[model samples]
Target: MIEVAGDSSRDGDWALVRLRVEGDRILEADADGLGARLGGLSLLEAAAVPGEPLAVDALANALGPIFRARRDSGRVAVAMSGGVDSAVALLRSGPKAIGVTLRLWLDPSGPSAERACCSPEAVLAARRTCHSLGLPHVTLDLRESFRRAVVEPFVRGYGRGETPNPCMRCNGSFRFGQLLDFARRAGADRLATGHYARIVERHGRLLLARAADAGKDQSYMLARLDPRRLRQIEFPLGDQSKERTRAEARAAGLEAAGRADSQEACFLAGDDLRAFLVRRGLAGESGAVVDDEGRELGRHDGFWQFTPGQRRGLGVATGTPLYALRTEPRANRVVVGPREALARRRVRASGRLFAPVERAEVKLRYRSPAVPARVEPASRGFVLHLDQPAYGVAAGQAAVLYEDDAVVGAGIISSSSAT
Candidate 1:
């Protein structure tokens, strides 16, 4: 029997009793933490090793010096987002694991449509797993910082008539920066997360590559992670499939096992971007919708609420199907045109991050397929030569570059100059 003087609920002090059961009969406590009641777990499970208690103490006595030697070594600091990925990430970290989740605002509206990770519920999920695993946990409030780094840029980008990708900014500028700093403070040598991306040393420089599981690869979103930061980052889920990760979480008895994944732009609070914009004071500012020749076709509530290449909720009428061809920020006007108008071949990108490349696979948006492109250095930035024109490729959006499956670099699309 395992006895201790504390409550399991509040983490005062208690002994975790790992019991082996045979149809409700208590057999024994398995130290292997596998099917020995805890031993035969897969290699992916770091806690799957089985050990008898007496054996454990004997082994500890035998290996005490070695254990003590490594005890002072830096451990992994995990970023838990309240999902299976992060839940498993923390559980899989080695002996010195610590968990931390960020408190990000939930947007009132906008694509709660695209689901991925990050939300308030994710924070609690992370904490729960940490408690269950007997690990220390911390949560950092980042609402104001998120607004300045992500939300404000989104508003300004749309206001300037460009499709801004706040997610990329969050990954590159905010998430890694904040969490990595925390890792340093916590005496961790490495920061780990659930992002389905891989880092490998290529040509003496650390570079990002696609996860082995193609369906869950997240390299595009992480293109913004520079070599310096990428050096200190690790993705435990990169080599594992979602099914395997979930199974591992279940095996660990983590509370996040059955928890649902988070939605895109989750900070919006609700699913209405237009409503959120109105609340932000960009509402009620009606502007004109025009064509290239400056001919007014219709009117809009505000130009700051629209994005390029958008084909819905236009509130405009034309003989043919119209698409958001461009936005005239100075005029506060949105220009619509035939669907053909959306096709563009040459895309210009600013704020470029490159490893001296003249070619790469360019992904325009998260879901869009990467296409072969020639990267020509421009006087101010870089120019992308698409093999075939892409529709709705907008500025203020990120264009992640890949050599084969590894991301060599990425840039912010400035605009398209198509005839």
Candidate 2:
């Protein structure tokens, strides 16, 4: 049975909630009718502690001092990644910042095991840093939501022989969207992140711009943020160099100042995904790994072992180099082809998250240079006409759009077989 446990003061001063995430877990409820009344709350808080009384006023006061202090800069909800970037963001934003870190689930099985933004250790580190800086820290338990929104899609995408980019989805939609909801509920004004991207008003329209540090600029990964949300967000490291950011963090004496950078997709913690997948009970019954035209090249333990455009470790030693081009889930086979087969000049992206405007830059992958493209609106999606064909455009990956360097919007790459 589902239940909720919470404590509230006489005036509803503070509310502490304990939630049960799974069906097997029991959350005790106050049956005395004296339980705190959870009335109307914004959708964001509702996702966290549902059915709780509205503490809107309290949330407001809690956010008031910071907003007032900013006077010019405005209040911001900073996503703390338990690393130097976000740590410095929190310090720099000062009173206007509420540090938040999500505790995303780490699947025992998944490729590229690395410590992600969500881990017990990472959460604790973020909390300590926030407390040390005299700022309140909140841990948003988004494990279930994350699984549905990211992990599940990743697995399914891979199964379909596509490459997925969960970071774009999490950053552009789930994470920031939730933060904005938090701001509205708490009466805060804006949100911020340690991303090396910039936000500026160009020609009266807010734009997501590139950061000064090319090496650290994450505009590509964040190309999915809606243009409408730009006014309510901040990217402080945009104009600053990575070295200067470190210097600033050092000058502020933050613990995360010297902390090593967390690699992409922290949930994996460096574990091998194939093993994890097997542990998760998706062990393979051996499938055929084939070359173009249904020619059997070798065999794979499972279809999950391959992704679109993957070129290494094919097990089969063909005289000519080969790369994964597709996964035929129906046949439980992975399709391989020559390296030249990866190129594409046109991309059709559907279920797009934002509307397109004129010519923009399209990024095929993170850290990949932005390619000039004319993004044309296609129903609920978009069609990217690239200046030059881009190779390795995986269907599950995101086709993020940019104009003048800011992330305007993004969508899943539905097809990139454009010649």
Candidate 3:
């Protein structure tokens, strides 16, 4: 059993809540008779009552001692996202775990900011999960850095008519890099996250592989990570199914157990990407939708809004269903054709590999099946010649190559051509 107490103040109303927890369940709670059922509520949640005032950062400072003790205790820094997966990860890491949440500055002009992963609301929820377990949590403010590192690139990619997966860049590069640095500074031994992926050794080199739950595998999003950093990272949930994680959290009385999963683009937070781009001053311009031979078929508000293989929202209906073949940002034109035109047996990708390979399975898109392909070494990048054609291959999207469930290498699809 553990005991925790914290103060909360909001809009001049100050209150304090204290709780006693026992084996994943709250035994008793006292909040000056605020009528809160503190049994299942985390300490931070109890402090977030209506008219209760408590700054999230201040709460972290108040709970600093809980973390300071673990600094030299071989602690593992767990990245919390205010969700069940992360909460269970911390639980498995034991009391020597410290929770860390990065607060990013989301687009102010977008929809409800509270919904995003790095929003203030999420940070508080994550802190609550930590406090419930008598563990310490810290929030890192990375608003400006996040904008420069992730958001700006996202806007620029869309402006250039390239469909970039911002999440991949964030997780593979920025997010994990920051977390690893934080873990080192905090005297922690390792950095852990709830991502459904694993690290395994292949021929004396560290390699990332799919999680036990293939359906929830996030290996593709992390395929671009610098391999040198793999040894210091940990994914405790890699072998557990999402269903089992949820069940563990629910058994522990964690509020996050029932929380919905976060959005793919945390910055978008359920807002339309096109609308978000327009608000960020990357608005699209009216353009012509043309056939492959440059014959105008219809008019479009903007070519940036359409991606290769998209069949809906074309605004121009041909006699048959049409798909976006390619987008020309220079001409501000969108090329539309039949679905068959989107097929490609070859993809020239530009990116480095974690390991050299002569043959591997190539996955063009997240949900698409991995196809058998021949990998040829090239000067600037590599080439994938698939045994069978795949549809909707687009530039700026990641082409991750795998060998026996391990992500051997990955690159951006620079071009896709018909066989």
Candidate 4:
């Protein structure tokens, strides 16, 4: 049984849906408003809410004042991560800002969960920052939603031998979606965050752009955001570098200005993912570590212990260092080889395109430089032909497309091949 609950209010719609799925079919479905009969409809064909669709002109004329009033007040709901970046953003939002901290679920047994910005201690710190600035603060308890939307899918992806990037899913999809919903209910015009990324309008469409500080640019992590929601978001730190942000924090007398940055995956909370998986009942089964040609080199406790492009922790000694090329969950095998074996010149990905450009620079990993690529339509999504081979490209990682500094499209790397 699966329950899907969504708010269409952002689109001026509402829906409550309950479903029972057995195998790949929806056995039973009960939906109210726009989600009615969702069991048989393709997701894209489903209505945003259950009512006769209203004309854009009619909706605009009816709700224009309400929208204008929100804009007039300059009220923005800022997402505070209890860190220097977000605290500084709250300070810059002026007196009309409200601080919101999302209390998400974390592994209870993880040693440093309290240190994460989503933890209770971090939440208190955010509230203190708001109080100091004479702004109101609210905390939304989203543990259940966060687990279902981000954490569970991450564990499942790893179990299937894929190295999924959960941060992108959380920030671009669930986090922004939740924040927009909260902003609508709070009667605010827009939601703000401290991310080092910019939003801009190009050819009448709002799109994401790289921050002024390119080294700290987070536009790649935010590439999956729905373009329609761009109008209601604000990035105060987009044009500011980390150095200047910290300096401003000191000038404002905020203690968090000197606080260290948070871990890459906040839910990990400084603990290893392997331990968390074990506690979640994904105990590793002994497996064989083999070369790409099926020559057994040594043994591993679990195939899930390895990720594509990983260069360390392989117990096998083959004279030369071996990098993990890929994991085969079905065969219970980990494939290791020379670093050159990981290079690939072509990639296939599945996801929607934010723009219709046929050619752009594609980035396979966050830290990897964007390489010139020829993009083309594919069966389910799109294909990328890189100008040069990239090393360590992995499935389940985002392939974000860019034209100059603007993000035009994004998708998951479903598979890759060496030229």
Which digits, one per residue and each the tens of the lDDT, describe model 3 over residues 1-419?
77766665656866665556654345686655343455675433433333222634444433332322224557788998888888998998877787888888787777776657888788888978987787767767788999999999888888888889888789877999988887875668888899999999885799999899998999999999888898888899999899999999989999999888987788988688778888888756788999999999888887889899998988776689999999998999999999999889999998877787889998888988999999987767799999999998988889999999889998888898997
User: lDDT scores for all predictions?
Assistant: 0.69, 0.67, 0.80, 0.77
Full-model lDDT, candidate 2? 0.67
Q: How many clashing residue pairs are found in candidate 2?
A: 18
Question: TM-score per candidate, in order?
Answer: 0.78, 0.78, 0.85, 0.82
Give the best candidate by lDDT: 3
Q: Residue 147 lDDT in model 4? A: 91
- Candidate 1 vs candidate 3, TM-score winner: 3
Off by over 4 Å in 4: 1-72
Model 1, 1-419: lDDT tens digits are: 22111112112422233433332123344333122442232111212122333332222222211111122245788998778888888877876687777776656444442233455456556656775676655556677788888888877776676777788889878889988877766667889998898988765678899999998898888888777888788898999899999899888777778877775566654467677766665655788988878888888887866676787878887668888888887878888888788887898886555467778888989899888888888866678898877888888888888887778778799878663
- Per-residue lDDT of candidate 4, residues 375-410 (tens digit): 987877789999999989988899999988889888
lDDT, candidate 4, equals: 0.77
Model 3 RMSD in angstroms: 7.1
Q: Please write out the lDDT profile of model 2 over residues 242-302, one tens digit for every residue.
A: 8988898888888888777886766656777676556655568678888778889898878
